[model samples]
Target: MSSDTKGALLDVVKGGVVSVTLFAAFLNLPVIGLPAAALTPFPALYFGLKRGNRAGIGLVLLAAVLVALAGGPEASVLYLGQSALLALALGWGVARGYSASRSIATAVLVTLGLAAAAAAVYSVASGVDLHERVVAGIRESISQALSLYEKRGIKGDELKPFRDALEQGGEVLSRLYPALLLIGQSIVAGINVMLLRRFANRLPAPIRIAPFNSFRNPDYLVWVAIAVGFSLLIDNNVVNAAALNVATVAGFLYFLQGLAIVRHYFETYSVPALLRYLFYAMLVMQAYLAIAVALLGLFDLWADFRRPRKPKNL
Candidate 1:
């Protein structure tokens, strides 16, 4: 083989090793495991963007094989669905010079499609409904949590209310799992994209990435959000569930818009880094603040908070 071919192959192997190592950390580590898993796609995405599609695909395939050998077929499937495929989608978009939002949307749609197809195949092969299975698993987890709480004392009436609340929450979560999955994968894609942008300069060819503060969803989305809001008034459980899912997704999009607005102001004012970090920390710890931010984003449609106001006549 030529030296160039040898170098490409070696790089692929190195990237694959990094991917698997991150996946392993995600599986084995406790608190930091999730963050590690979130980054499992980075190596493939980076290599693909830097070296080309084949290198990225090689990294992903090699990593999948390593995962399957170490963790079994199911784990390999999980890695592909959760990490590899997303990397491929994001890498494809970024390499083609797609906008950040467009790239993330493409990644989300592709991953969601793959997830639905995988669920259908699993249901068919196993002769079980995937939705029902997910609900059952959720309930099982709730039961385990309740048992743990009970073992820690607080019995009788306290326990009864807690159990009831847990059951209700689990049911809601089961219903919202699909929406949650979308939001989650979107987050994963966004993070990897941001990371790629941040480090893109290190690559041979640096790509242009628009400032995050400038992000804005299409205006038509507001109408859809309004429609979902109206649909929530319907009494039917099925309708309510579906509407809730759509609203949840819409809310998340608005929340991101709101964050972009916040970032814009922060940059305009040259906000201190420590204050910005604290504000972000508060957003994570205070749910109401997040909702408020989403509202801010929504109202920005009319308010145009990001737009510069013309100087008032003296």
Candidate 2:
């Protein structure tokens, strides 16, 4: 065979191999639906890496379908729109000769826009008007909260303050749909960064790896350990779920650490047979864990819009 023909055939085979491998690996996870939804950004990145954005439109569409099917009809629009933005951002970067920081900034902005657009589209398309429905849902939620408060038999005056607060919150949920979209966009962005770094090589060069000095950063470790440790202690009911809540956040961090380990090992020296097996094993394990934590995070975000946020001490 001609060298050109041989090389083209090899490339095709490799692409197919990678696609099947990634899809299968992802499918094995329990939270395939949500992670797959969050993963809407990945196929675009893959396509951009392999064939650029114009050619990647079809691939991104396919991932959108996979993601949408899992998130349900309500979120299908948002997922597909985000996927489209991801493709555009990646393609635009390649075409414009964007610096790494510029590409990242573009991706972040596009992700926010796409997420907000998706929310607006979904809100309008769903049978109920967003303003009315959000108000209703918030009221129903507040009533339930008050009923529980009553059962606790709190002093009547104490109940008044709590009830007043929820009444105010109900109004907020009704009008602050934009803020909610922003929160979702932030979440989707984090997932994209994770996927891009772990699989698509979309991050700035000198890709980070493990034995990371950041790992030993005392504050980070201490706070995370405390979060996870506290969650474990509280794992009783709705409150206990915060443990899994802690798990999702903590697990994603570990997932990144594990990915770095694999990268570092490869960068540091030759890949031994045993290490290769170990690396593959870790990848599979982390994929499952990432899925679980992502699902946990999903519920956490859904039930409580604000998880305790802290100002980062730079």
Best by lDDT: 1
Model 1 bad stretches (over 4 Å): none
- Sequence-dependent TM-score of model 1: 0.95
Tell me each candidate's RMSD, in Å, in order.
1.6, 14.6
lDDT of 1: 0.91
lDDT (CA) per prediction: 0.91, 0.53
In order of appearance, the predictions have TM-scores of: 0.95, 0.41
The candidate maximizing TM-score is: 1
What are the per-model numbers of colliding residue pairs? Answer: 0, 2
lDDT of 2 by residue, 128-217 (tens): 576566678779989999999899997588899998898887765555544454445545654554455565354333333222312211
**Which 10 consecutive positions of candidate 2 have the poorest summed lDDT?**
210-219
